[model samples]
Target: MSPALVNNSVISDMNTQENSEQRYRLLIYNYLSHKTTAEEKEVLLDWLKQSEENRKLFSDYKKIFDLTVSSDQKSRFSYRKPEALKRLKSKIDPSVSDARRLKIKRLKYYLQTAAAAILIFLIGALTSFWISRNQSVQNLSITKYEVIAPRGGKSEVVLPDGSKVWLNAGSNFRYGADYGINNRDVYLEGEGYFSVMKNPANPFVVNTSGLEIKAFGTSFNVKAYPEEKFVITTLVEGTVKIEGKGLNLSLKPKEVVVLSKESYEIKPDVDKVTTTSQLSERTGRDRSEKKEDISFSKSVQVKSNVNTNIYTSWKDNYWIIESESLRNIASILERKFDVTIRILSPELNQYTFTGTFYKETLEQILDILKLTAPLGYEIKEGIVVIKGEQKRKSIYDNFKTN
Candidate 1:
């Protein structure tokens, strides 16, 4: 053959191959849209199995078709699929030879098919970008902030609303970045002294495990230790309301409400003060004092004189115990010093201690307790074991008795 004829034949083969690929792509679109004939479906499947690239191209088109259909349904697009396909087919030229005209006609069909395919691809890309952007916006709406006062430590945090929280030892406080905007919400564990900034429209809410204290521009002390049986809310400067389990109590300044697991009680006399030293003397007494029964009456009010400073002074790092029990003091020391305290003597557990210590070492506090009470302590392996006066008998004594 001549060189010119050979080049013409090669060009013709290339054009035929391109026409076949264009027809295959259109068939794939029809197959995805459930508009293909049985023979066309068989041809599409065979072409997909011919090579990995062909399979990938079919897969990509199918994904775009499904995404576009779903997104169009959600967005309520005005363009119908049949109308789009019909409008695309009307623009083909028909005035050529039979075989060449068929090729050109299919070529025009390929361009129209590409227009719809590209439209669906762009719609899917825009939908994905919109969804991801919405998710990013939702994530940015609220930012969480947390403050922890570890054992033997105290911390102060000023919230976004200019409210100040003084966290005592072993306390956790958390609030969100949108704190003052809609409403001021804070979660508290253990104890916190809050001086809330007043916002009449957006009330402040302090949440504990048992109850919630709602306040507006008020200062209060909350003692909600997980180990303790009572949630104590003491109002210092402003009025506040405590609510839990269908019970509500409105508290005035210098008043305190104590919420137990089953009931709630109010102590009216915040001034009646008893020191822990006075209670310590009564520790070794008879049966009645040993059982500290918590009153569980819903919304029951009782009058007792308590020094309000004793409850709120921990904000100043002062631990004031007027008449607190040794068992209770041990619990406080455990959190304050971050140490385990074991009262070996059951009798010693009932003993009470009363004192005030600011920035005192655990050893220093223990030394003071030894002087004031019949208690001996041994610090071993990160634990303080308090022993009573009755020492254990020697093993030789049992042998001698035998």
Candidate 2:
């Protein structure tokens, strides 16, 4: 089939960059039309040498070739059915027919010196394109909108505005093309980071669970799951306005908001101190415990969120889940791990699972889950069977026993 047929929509107003792609497509179309010359083959080799990506694109297109072939008796058309493809345009319009016939005549006239050996093939192929055109009709993960990674897998998606998003296993984002325009809107069901494009005119908005975040070009993390009671939004940079029922909270960089149907809680940002203090009494420092004074500064000169890399690393193909819940963790697990999960109890929905594990393989992720909660699991091939148990701090305990 011609590149024009398969790519007519995208090709109609293609720019200069697409012209080279069109040339390569044309070469393939001609080669498949059984009109490839030994000299043209050498030219194709030279083009392939110019770029490695070109070779891969050509190789990947071999699938199109495999799908187009119907029979062996009609061996004259070696590359899928050219006649079917052409006929698809409009019953082989007379203009194209005449063009085909004339092209054949001209080729014959030029090769009059060596046309006798494969006489019938040369004649049939001039008309083969007309034949292929007639026949053979045919035909990310869980995230804010609708997402869940396929089991044992994860994915990374970059929005049009240069903002990066990391989808956890079995998680997916619901972001169609209508992003970065009127609203820069994204609906994520699981967990994701927003390294937003600075657009004062268009504030980025993310909706998950029952909470919504409006940002002014910032970076942040949001975790919302079916089993969890509250939606958690953690700001890592800039500022984010989070809203929920009876809740309108603005979080500064490094601040976090926990919103639930019953109540909303805001956590103030604490100054970061060394988890282990080196300047203690042993190090000749004052042993006074009078309310420690510390300050958490932004990674950027201006006050921004710390943990920028840890927060938005998934966009760069890294999975870093902080203290999250089973309800929320399941959502992130789906995207980074690429699998499906179910919350057996709606009451358990808000049961938070908090741990920090590097994003990776689905099995390894599930193994980490076993360690974080009172749960047992078995992995056979691609399927994982999870058995949940209640712990003293169980989020699921609030609901009735099964």
Candidate 3:
């Protein structure tokens, strides 16, 4: 298309936006003036059909108009115009160009014309709109979302922007409930797997603790806790950027970025520890996306491997530990059950464990722990107790001694 045509199209779009607001005001005026001619009605219908946006604007205008003007208000008009319109008025000094004196009119008539007359010329500049007077128009654009998982229970929620979140037992997360026309954002606590919606233009963002993960659209897992110092972000598929404190790193699929708890930092590194899901996705060959000359390979590898199932274990209603320090492992148990676990033997912290279990009750999980280590634990009320095996080294030892 020629520049001339492009300019004309943009001008037309602007004109259409302007015409929408004008039509709304006109509709209200016609209703008030009892001048609803067939031609005016046809014009209204035409505008409504131009775009769903036009209908939304029209409906919003009628709501505000009816709310501000009623039977009692019929005798007097008191139109304050939207704040956006008022600001535009100050920008264009309507007093200088379009000022006129009319004969004495009733309060309602004068009020209606006073704002409308000034607003008529400035409508083009007031594109940001306000509707719903009961709730600020801004509130309706985006809402707040919050989800919490109780002890031993977990939650799964799909956000409005099409991102899926899995909250671990005893964990919670909050997000801007509404994904606006141009952007999506969320906040996380503990750990969760996110299969984010893809939008090549606008990136999805997850903010947690001091870390920020940004991606156009991809699947990833983030683990951040206020009680704990470290924040770990693992990329399952697609690309992501991790930024926190004074550190920032871009990651590839199969890579994990661990920001240090003590210094809140990460030395630059490339990671490539494969996941089960990543293996499943590399199956369908897309000719268009593949390049013959370029190598399809990993520039960097991961610090460790993550079983897609165990890495995303919270999503599957199980806790799997693979050579994980007992302290970190217990913390996961704490978050899942919303309880504090005191390690009577902090030396147990030095021990790393590897184990997997299906969905088990809280008591069952703790029992499993006792079988693997010389520790006795019990849940009284909601508190969990971690004790050394007294004089008995194990459940068998206690039985033998008895």
Candidate 4:
């Protein structure tokens, strides 16, 4: 027999199965055609309950049938059961051995199984493609917004969650559109005073270059200047948790945590000092090698009587300097005046000045420095040059009266 004749004989044998089996096959066909009567659906449900294999086979056949008869394929090629049967019969030669007919029956089974497997693979591939495409769209929907305070300028911004932020001169703040909804996250460069709104469930997080500050309904000041070697976080109200390198510390009201760029000698009596051993324990490093490899020291939590206003007064348009070095003072003036300041004398850099300037011009502030410290400043264009003042000799001294 030819392959088509043998395949027809196999189909005939399937139709000659027990009544229940034949009814099950007919129910599967009815489901594929979407024309199952209520009684046929009930019978199919009972058959599916007999075994897991039965349910799986039925599902695979249903998928294959749906794919074959889909509208796109139907428009291109009309498939009719009678036409398919006629084509098979016309192609078959009715003179062959039984052995050849058995082989043809096995081939028909393999072809049906392969077709079902291919349809399943295609469905899975399309599902995965759509899932990835939707994820990309979601990522594109998240927009990032950045606010910058120019040199000698200060800005105030309101976040999407109604939190208020005061950005100091030369500061930058950024947040995304999904900030409050998914996560209240912000990145800060330079200084910012945040008055966070209380949402205990979603804590507000402020990320600096080296530290992360998590706060809940709190007001705090973060000073992390790129030029400076320290990142200082001061909590004025509520509470905040600070994390950096291998340190995690919590701050209360009027508490300050300082993160330095250099390792310092650990003292026994210091307040909440994180030692090299503690760092090694957290980071899984040899204590000796850890110290040398770590650029930033463990955070130092200190209790001081120093006025907090000196650190936070800049947000109110006031510069409260108290015994701060001229080098540090010059840094402030540069930002306040939006000008470049060069100190010619290294000795002058250490001279400490204490005063408060409110709405003062660059020349006026420079004059105040001259009287308090033996420094002379000259401004040409936008740069200010500061040098030590020279002393004048008296006429008697010049004549060598002694």
Maximum-TM-score candidate: 4
lDDT of every model, 2 decimals:
0.63, 0.51, 0.57, 0.65
* Candidate with the larger lDDT of 1 and 3: 1
Over 4 Å off, model 1? 1-141, 262-305, 391-402
lDDT tens string, model 3, 147-193?
65444455566555435666655556666534545666677877777
State TM-scores per candidate: 0.54, 0.39, 0.52, 0.55
What's the lDDT of the predicted structure labeled candidate 1?
0.63
**Residue 385 alpha-carbon offset, candidate 4, angstroms:** 0.2
Q: Clashes in model 4: which pairs? A: 1-96
**Regions of candidate 3 where Cα sits further than 4 Å from its true position:** 1-142, 177-180, 265-305, 390-402
Candidate 4, residue 337: the lDDT equals 59
lDDT of 2 by residue, 1-402 (tens): 334443443224446777867766766666666655565566667878989898888876666876776433234243225534544543456565444431221111111112232222122233222222333462222112233333233344545555655554334466544467556877787666666757889888887776678987876877675555545577766888866544455666665544443333333322221222322221123312211221121110112233444454554455565545566566555433334566554544544554455434556666776665557666554344566666632654454464
The better candidate by TM-score, 3 or 4, is 4
- Candidate 1: RMSD over Cα atoms? 34.6
Ranking by TM-score: 4, 1, 3, 2
- Model 2 score (lDDT): 0.51
Q: Against the true structure, whose lDDT is highest?
A: 4
Ranking by lDDT: 4, 1, 3, 2
User: Mind giving the per-residue lDDT tens digits that candidate 1 earns over 204-233?
Assistant: 999896577899988789989887766778
Q: Across residues 1-402, which tens digit of lDDT does each residue of candidate 4 receive?
A: 233442333234544447546656656876666666555566577878989989987888788787887453353234234434533563584342221221100011111111332111111112212222434646565556666665666666656555777788778777775679889989999999887879999999999966689998988899988887667888877889887655666766766666663433332333223442333222224333434433344445344333566777777677889878899888877875567899998878877889998866777788898876667888886788999865512332455576
- List runs of model 4 lying over 4 Å from the truth: 1-140, 262-301, 392-402
